[model samples]
Target: MQYKPLIMGILNVTPDSFSDGGQYCVQAEALAHAQRMVLEGADIIDIGGESTRPGSDPVSEGEQLARVIPVIQALRCHLPSNLLLSIDTTRSAVAEAAIVAGANVVNDVSAGTDDPRMFSVAARAGVPLVLMHMQGRPKNMQDNPGYRDVVEEVLTFLVERAEAAKDSGIRPENIIIDPGIGFGKRKEDNLRLIADLRRFVATGYKVLLGASRKKFMGAICGETRPVELMGATIATTVLGVSAGVSMFRVHDVKPNRQAADVTAAVLRT
Candidate 1:
């Protein structure tokens, strides 16, 4: 499962995802979309039950499991076996159930700090874990968020998290780090992240860049529509790719995949 600069497609199963709310909440539609992404060149399917966007409400454990389990099971049954599955949630219970249902990875936005058991879960399941850096809770992450030095702060947070995960039995190669562009950032901070992405990668973990229709993209393009953020998102992807990002968690699977192909052919040489 060595993903060297792979594209991890975003599949939000929640009813209110900012990117595509309720688009694939239904079991059949979710399966169809998952298959579509796979066909479009998604190396990994990252299924998320809870929306971690700014001002988002929390989904209960039962709702989270209900939203994610069926989709994971259906995809595992219908999609190719080699197609990787990454569950996005902070609850240990949900991660456990998703792994049992067929998730090969755990993508915790809280970076294993929220659920203490996530480290053990990844260890037991023997799967990769994505650690994302978020300053505060999702509800108020976008409100007056400030950092003395965004890059250094995020880098320190990720370093501490990686040490903790290693202490909890998660292997070094099995760990991935995400800068969390929109989770709690202003325009300048997000831009700084895009520019300093290589600094984070120098920390020695696979970097996963998740800039799919984020708020900063909207601010940059002067567009409120999430879909319109695609072009700016591509620009950031190009920058991140040049900075040596290991994987991408994105919504536009086809374009990102195509862009990644070009990037791999041209830049990563």
Candidate 2:
């Protein structure tokens, strides 16, 4: 069987996220958006309550739980039983609460570094954990982001984090690594990662590529608005597919789905 990359639709239930923030803060709106993504062929729905964009202030744990739990609960009740739900959080407490509420995966951008307990939470839950590579905290990651050989540095960081997760009792099979495109990368760095994505894939862990409407697209295409970067996002999706990525985290699900399907078909030929 030809391997088809999975699509993880983004659901940001925060008022300050870089893209589509306040738009889905309401529980009903978030659920509705999730249902739409499911219909659009999303294999997973990633719910994030805090804004991780550069220079963003952190939200309290109480606020993060309040914002995401209700939506996860609602989606669990309304969506199919097999629809994978992923909680995008850096805090262990939030990840625990979300898993209890019905999330099956943890997408931590900090790769278990933000909160020491994050790895333990994933281990206890025995669920898939996405450990992404970011240069620094969201507040300062973009401040003159420097990387010596971006691809090598990111691959090294991901390997180290994956080993740490396994050492923390997280099953090796549950591990996924993401070369975070915009978290703390320059436009050239982002381009280099995408161009050299096969290196991350060769590490033998499932690789996730999240180039969805990021600032690099704006820097390259002169599309400042996040919404205006969908074309660029789709273009990167095609590149990622060719690079053997196992999944894509995207804001616009339908278009990316089509692109991934077509790319997968072409690659098969």
Candidate 3:
């Protein structure tokens, strides 16, 4: 019942991120936010340049590269050298650039299905990578998606994809799996996956649950705005801790870290 939570702080450098959008798009603000989150208990900071919100269009690879590199450079130069830096992208070129700029983790929300080169990038980088499970492309994921059994299908996909990544030369220890709570799932599917997350951990790989501030939280909280779903986010973090989740991707770092600490304390008792 012990919790070893790997809190990956969200650093979305986009104009349309659900929260903290445009707020951190400026170089100075972004640097300050990264520093604060690391001080607030973020083991890692996930730097993403593109917005993958519902109905959002994809950014050009060149543009995406431009957005994240400078921020990563600042982080590498100013933040603690041991601070874990993650590039939240599926582009191999971006991955390579981020690594060369000193990022250590590659968090591909596409699960490497979008770009065939993703797995190979992780392999060559020799760093830990997170494979997030999403049903389809971000732009169309919420367009009336249907899955006969989301939990089963998602688990299968994670297993297959993890194996594929391993075969592509990524070691098992260098991999983490995320359920991708809102990408293509309804509220029910997300809940069931959280309830049954131990099955994923049983695979001997770490499971990182990223259900923070998602649309489902708004639906659960009956709020229209992303900021209003924070209480629900805390609840999900507690539930995730109860299920032995290894990491959490969140916008609210201090609250999530505190929730995790309390949950871990109770479970230990």
Among the numbered candidates, top TM-score falls to 2
Superposing all C-alpha atoms, what RMSD in Å does each candidate have to the true structure? 1.5, 0.8, 1.3
lDDT of 2 at 117: 95
| lDDT score for residue 179 of model 1 | 94
How many clashes (backbone atoms < 3 Å, residues ≥3 apart in a chain or on different chains) does model 3 have?
0
Return the lDDT, model 2, position 26.
Answer: 80
TM-score, per-candidate, Cα-based: 0.97, 0.98, 0.97
Off by more than 4 A, model 1 = 1-4
Residues 67-175, model 3: lDDT tens digits: 9999999999999999999999988899999999999999999889889999998899899989989877888989887789888999999999999999999999999
lDDT of each residue in 81-132, candidate 2, tens digit only: 9999999999999999999999999999999888989999999999999999
lDDT of 1 by residue, 42-108 (tens): 9999999998878998889999988899999999999999999999999999999999999998999
Error of 3 at 61 (Å): 1.1
Of 1 and 2, the candidate ranking higher by lDDT: 2
